[model samples]
Target: MKQPSIARLPRMLKLVLTRRAGFGVRLALVGAVFTLIAGFGEASAQAQTQLALKFKAGDTYQQKVTTRTISGGEVAGEQVKTTLQQEMLISTKVESLTEEGAGNLSQVIEQITLDIGLPKGKSIAYDSNQKEFSDPILASLHKTLGKLAGARFEFTTTTSGEILNFKMPAALTEMAKNQPGGGMMGDSLSEANLRRMFEDAGVSLPKEPVKKGDSWTRKASVKLPIGEVTSHLVFTYDGPENDTLERIVVSGDVEIAPAEKSPLSVKLNSTKLTGLTFFDRNLGRVDSSSMSQVLNVTVAAGGQTNDLTIESQVEMKIVPPKK
Candidate 1:
């Protein structure tokens, strides 16, 4: 799977991978995950559970997302290796229901933590809950990443989990603007871009109900650190994982979007993506999901070429409201 190069990616994405000023920009990408979960379902009605997403006003849940990514390659005749680990806790509440039965949702980032491993054994760590930072870089990042802990967004979705509208807080955009290499963060966070991301990455539900062993295909265009990748995914309803949960399995292959001309050129050596999702039938919502993705890319830019391999694992879990 060969595709476009990193140069085709948004400036914000480039900064995160190559410059220290990119942490805050990464937050915008993380924030996008909230909407991704809402796009997870579409199944046949032949099963005991309808598979349609449902929400009730006053209902609340907490989602915890953990991601670990590792990238290694060579640039300018020097070996470069980096690893990023991020964890975020998001709280979601159903504020109201529209006449058309859409769920008006309010979401807030309650906490976040990051650990980055740079070349030469150097590392940077930050936790929104921590008060002290021994490293200047970490301290500077705190000024911006700290603010993300309480950032909020609002959106509306239909019963089947289709997004109708979404709003990004102005404060968040401002925070990004203040960071280094952040000039383009605002553009990526704009309503149009966010909507495009949603539409490209989202998984559509089937028009009608489906039974166990049934499967459907979803085409997703995902934005990676390198560039946008279009994937062909087959999602299968694997029936019940347990009495309380239904299972869905996803398998996919990705290809980089081609570019006509650019300073950078990319060759995707190999790639793989897979996921497993558990839906809480009793709650009519997702209980948990996990994904694994790996890509091997050779990028040429500035008269230099680097063979980079990226591996990422993401886990998302929803905690039920306390009685």
Candidate 2:
């Protein structure tokens, strides 16, 4: 008997493919997450000593980025590229000081305007920008912030029209707590779990450690629907006291399939960080700085190998809090 076509495969096989596709997209998104957190962490760690680093106060920063996406394996046909120039303004106001460290931040606001340039033959066009794009985006933001804690505003314009909205989500408040390097559970982990894990790791952050080449590593098993995935995260610090986070590297293998599923696997071997900068607490501005990283991803299925490359850069201005 002849083998059946892939389209005629069993439901279970189809489900496997669907899951793999979703996993691929998640992997790509993970790269972006790494970039954001790595940069955020370096800056936050360096600025930890800055006076009055409390909530209910506002600050603004500017970031410029140049990123490129390259794909192979199943995604070989598509080429993705974008250049982003943007500004971010953040403000906070304490609504009620219920307790010394536990008060409600009533007004938390963020304003972002980005100029996005897409590659030829690929463009984003929409009518009723507010209804089509702004609403959903804002809703997600608000849900992410909730009743108190985090808020944001996004406005975008094309030659065609404009987009504007606001959102507040409580989860953002939690994420902000880990600002810079907290991973997946940074936003959702309970305080008790966080403390327990920190203690288990024997992690002790100094008020000020002599700035030098410092590195830390962690290994953990993450439970997924398919199976348990082992993850390893490595953080590296390279910078003088003036600027911190010279580099960061993360490498790990995630089990994409089990004994019954297809013999497939996904591996992420990426080193995402090159240069970083710290905000001048007194100056309230992004000190001049730059960062770069190269990432490689490999996927194996049915004895076939697919690979991809991602390169990214981040440059930003440190500005003072509004008066």
Candidate 3:
């Protein structure tokens, strides 16, 4: 088998780092996203219900998440489209509980597969489970993200699922430090970045108990590799779906601003985000959640402009442990 040209490796790596780094961030903190959305209602609500996350020592759960992003438009007056898809398996365990009932949680990525499809049907694919790569781009991605498999992140969160403190694995920091743009990558992996991406994007439960038909809105801004995004989400509690699960409806709008001191600038022409979460009060976990986002933006880089329409769909589901 003829190997891909070595000359293309640099451009490929840059493209992955610049355009898809947010997916890496998502892979890192997807567990927290699930946990936060899972604690929507307590089991004991008649007219009003308090929301809290419950965890038991030694309890463990798994989540399977799939995300797909498609962007199409013109780059430098040339038409282009790119599609990225990722599938990940993550495991979360309750290491212990605080005196206040908060959980000391640990999450690890078990498996991951990423595929990026570009115009003309050219594509790059990587799987952490794959051992050998004939293509240089796949080998590079394998070195960067493949190292993430089994990397553990530990954190403490309140009963409401608000993160208090987080610890990034030393290997991850070292991994970023070894990358081409190590400084920027390292900063992007900092606690501040993690919190902004994970916490700000998380579902913030109501401060007080909420009855059926109650609705609240939360606003947050988070920095991503693409840019800084401000989101406005309105959540409506639709009450219980059945005896065990509560359903919440989510809809939102998002706007993007270019990151300071970056060559890439993004102007959002229009954006929308919508989702639904099913929380199982009896299981104390979110059984399933799905979200979709569409962003229409003009990206300026190297004195050229790319008008793109990006659409993303994310679905997460809890995986039951083997008996």
Candidate 4:
């Protein structure tokens, strides 16, 4: 073959490199945004339903969470992972529910055996009792970081369930205040932000006349720091007295760019309802035989589609104290 010009070769190489780098950046950005949206949506849903449950003291329940992520239409090859084990304890007063422990992938699994005392107007306190972890490195780091980061944290929360007011040990608070993006400091929950989100979404509680098999769908237009997104929340009451939420389906479309958007959506379908029980007299209920199916997770930025399916069942016994 005839010798090619060096100058032409360099120009072609530069163009190829530039194109590759741009593609990589776009892919990363799309993935990050999708992950954030999924996570935020789940958190928002949990906060909204947290207070709706009429749980009494001495009531306890356990739940397991399994999650998997798919990108560019391919199963990230990682099997379903058990994210956490949840233990919810309800106190005599409505504001005293406590979450015992949570397991994270990176850090040591710590038992958050803190009791929440909801005094008045979103004022809350954390009384840490015991600490347990399997990893030695994590334990040591947690001990040093926990104290340095204010072992005990308290704050006033926002209505959207996002933490707004944070009160940490003086030393930790000062340190965080000195750092950038440290506003979170020592806050645990943010009720104010959550309430604001619900307000913007035009979400409302189901009216008292709610009966079995009644379903309601609401549309929420959310404006995040990055962009605007729309979400649909569909709630259905499968049992009488609205004791159990038989089905909850969430789906939405998000705009990734001016000309491109994600037809991204998710549907949590129910297949079986087992161990479903309710005690209206005492404000207690349990659904030991409930299962859900997640289907069709799509990302439309790079012309890729990933289909994901999730099957989960939760079992628990909740007994409310005498009213």
* Top candidate by TM-score: 3
Shift in Å, residue 73, candidate 4: 9.2
Alpha-carbon RMSD to native, per candidate: 22.3, 26.0, 22.8, 27.0
Taking all chains together, the TM-score of candidate 3 against the true structure is: 0.77
For lDDT, the strongest prediction is 3
Cα lDDT of model 2 by residue, 189-282, tens digit: 3333322321222111222332344555555443332234444444344443444322222333333233234244656665454554443334
Ranking by TM-score: 3, 1, 2, 4
lDDT of each: 0.73, 0.39, 0.75, 0.34
lDDT of 4 by residue, 197-256 (tens): 223211223533344445565554433322333445455544444544333222232232
Deviating ranges (above 4 Å) for candidate 3: 1-46, 76-78, 177-188, 195-203, 217-222, 321-323
Candidate 4 ranges beyond 4 A from true positions:
1-92, 95-189, 192-205, 217-231, 239-323
- Candidate 3, residue 250: lDDT: 85
- Residue-wise lDDT of candidate 1 within 1-323, one digit each (tens)? 99879797656556655665476766766455434433444323333436766779999889888889999877777888899999888888899999987789887878889999999999888899897888888887677667667878788877666777788688766744554332322234445455544333223455457688788787656443335568787778888898898898988888996444445578989998999888787887778888889999998878777899999988888765434
Stretch of 10 with least lDDT, candidate 2? 156-165
Query: Which regions in candidate 2 have their CA more than 4 angstroms from the true location?
Result: 1-88, 92-109, 112-120, 125-206, 209-265, 270-272, 281-290, 300-305, 319-323
lDDT of 2 at 322: 56
lDDT of 3 by residue, 1-323 (tens): 99776455455343444554578675555545445445533434446877667889999888888889998997766888899999888888899999998889887878889999989989888889898899988876677667777778788877765787788788877755565432334355545565554453234566678888788887777556666778888888889898888988889898776667777788889888989888787766678888899989888889888788999998888877545
